[model samples]
Target chain A: MLSMVKECRRTKVFKPVLDHIPYAKFIGMGCEQFGDEYIFTLPSNDNNLGNPTLPAIHGGVLGGFLENSAIIHLLLKLDTPRLPKTIDFSIDYLRAGRHKDTFAICEITRQGRRAANVSMYAWQTKQSEPTAVARAHFLLEST
Target chain B: MKENNEALADFCQRGMADIKHSEVLGIETVSASNESITLKLPYSLNLVGDMETGALHGGAIFTLADQTSGFAVFSHLHPQIRIAPTLDLRIDHMRKSTKGMDLFCTARCYRYTDNIAFTRAVLYENDIDNPVAHAVGSFMFLETVKDQGWLK
Candidate 1:
């Protein structure tokens, strides 16, 4: 367990918008705490292709990023060591991701003993538009 | 032996090109006509140590649904046509998957218009009788190329 936590800290997974998801290293979904905002960036890779072309950031990747953002926010605020279970996630892909790059800035709306709620917007460079938006619910484990 | 079958094989190949980056969650061969595609949960892809419990991670499941849905749409498109990111997706976990279990997913596109295509995915684990989760999603065609202003 301690090693997992250590792994979490060593990797981008412990960072906001990047944790708890697969392929973080390849996709470039890194986390940075920028003063009041928690920013997550999704870097483009070889697989992201289509008409408009994208890092091909899959919706599942976006969902994972948002979900991680929510739980990490809760973890940062609390004095507990509990893992979070995703209750539900709803994501709206507003625009297709362009090859340049993209990411999201998230904020926690509510944090309770058992559950937490978070919302975020994903913006890409080429489109300069909000490509996706998400709201997720998480259940915290007991410490 | 048929054009449709050839296409299905190609689609799966392209989808699974990057095994390390994206594991095959599940692949269900629907009818030969490319009517519907169902994929199972990708048992192998998950957090370390977490994989041992055989519990299907929600993120993996969601990614599977998205990829399956994307493939479902791609199967019907022209050879050159391809889809980008999912425009929208909503997933609900009905229950946890069985331990060390493989999941099943059935994805179908009910409607296909010029701009967007819609799909539904049903995911099951040990028992097909009860599904572990359900997902409904849509993807938009990136048919046009624009000067992505960000590059400048």
Candidate 2:
């Protein structure tokens, strides 16, 4: 697992895929491997703010981040190199995402031949207390 | 009805301008009424998600739908309410959007109470009958906190 993570980074496999995604770059989302785990980061930017008065991150941005995180997680974990297509995404806003660096962690709940389900949690300060949680279903191409 | 629509359009435009992300995505008010409101998101290279297909990112589509839903709530409440924060949102991607084509979203606030508002939105490129995405969202009205100047 560690070797695979290193290979993905050293070979410039995932970086290019992420770089090519203009929306991911526009929001300044980055992924890093830590001890065989991948963590997605979204740096706070004024252009990503949804509610200026409350200075909160947009709900859609959060949704996007979570969805992308799930896709990237699948890329890293699954053997298939193809990008997963999102089918449906459901998100619950537990608390306001403040203007701060946010982090997301994804767990694959179930992986089938044709589809996979991923659950994601995003938080600012504490992982235990997530600002938002989401579940996404993606259609995977058979290799 | 025309005068009312014009007034709602002005209000929607102002609301869109106040959002930094909406400005970044170039979301504009297409039409506005108390019954429903439509918004447009112009296509840009910066909004692409799929490098192979050159399709617009699902996140960008979600943002447009989310904003349109919020605006629908605003149009429904009008002068009675000033702010409604999103409580939760769910989006279903029906199909991949065509590249270089602008996306449009129309949303309606179907139900509301003093504290919460419910809305649904459809996103499309050309035909409303064939939407690329659909969204349902609930928003929280801060009327109870109005005494603390929270609504101001």
Candidate 3:
């Protein structure tokens, strides 16, 4: 039991790093882990809006949200929180992100010794019909 | 042509500045032309990714690249169309950013079909010749705003 507590304490590295990221806090990004899945949440806020005409959220914000989800997932999943550095990121925007609470989920497709790949999906209304899909590779430095 | 270009440059600058997310991220337009534009993002703790290394977050950098890509699309095919939403984007982060150094991105739309426009962009700091990241993307064109005089 003590070993499990120690392991959980070690994984809490994402807290400080995320707290320092003003952009994440400003956008109100939160996360919850359910079993093997890490779900990201972005609260509805005016500052996140990009197009006043359509009242759509900024594309940058969406990309950022997905990428951040990747980081948080990797940090929590791995035993050591050595801070994941992004090597590449790709995103597909399927539909406009309307003003509302957004949610995203990340899956580590492959985690090799040096590099890890993550796939992220974000949606507002329906999970099946995602607003955007993003994939990213990160160089892990946990050693 | 000159009138169209001038009007376009004005519209691009004002509209980009007015975007709330851009304001929060401290994204500023360095210059804009009929074909492309350069944007600047100053270094701030707000964008930090690794508190230990003081490296800027990849998401912040991606935001700059994504926004620059959008501007490239606008300069290429907007006004003619009301808006161009991103259809796809791919970015390669070549290296870690220098601590406390501002980043800049210059993107240009190199191709356009009836409904799709393609763009390529580079993100760098200090020396523009050495880029820290590269991106390629496409945008989808939408309706023509009458007031935009896109048809004119």
TM-score of chain B of 1: 0.73
Best by DockQ: 2
Candidate 2 C-alpha lDDT tens digits along A9-124: 67645666577578889888988778777899999999899877678898889988998899888877887656788999888899989999999999999999999999999999
- Residues A64-90, model 1: lDDT tens digits: 656555555555544445556677888
Question: What tens-digit string does per-residue lDDT give for candidate 3 at A36-69?
Answer: 6667888888888887766788988899899988
Write the candidate numbers in order of decreasing lDDT.
2, 3, 1
i-RMSD per candidate, Å? 5.6, 2.4, 2.5
* Clashing residue pairs, backbone N/CA/C < 3 A, model 3: none
TM-score of chain A of each: 0.71, 0.90, 0.86
Candidate 2 at residue A79, lDDT? 71
- Binned by DockQ into CAPRI classes (incorrect, acceptable, medium, high), candidate 3 is medium
Which ranking of candidates, highest TM-score first? 2, 3, 1
Worst 10 residues of 3 chain A by lDDT: A1-10
Q: What DockQ does model 3 achieve?
A: 0.61
Candidate 1 displacement at residue B23 in angstroms = 5.9
Poorly placed runs, candidate 1 (over 4 Å) = A1-28, A43-55, A126-128, B1-10, B18-33, B45-54, B75-85, B142-152
CAPRI docking class of candidate 2: medium
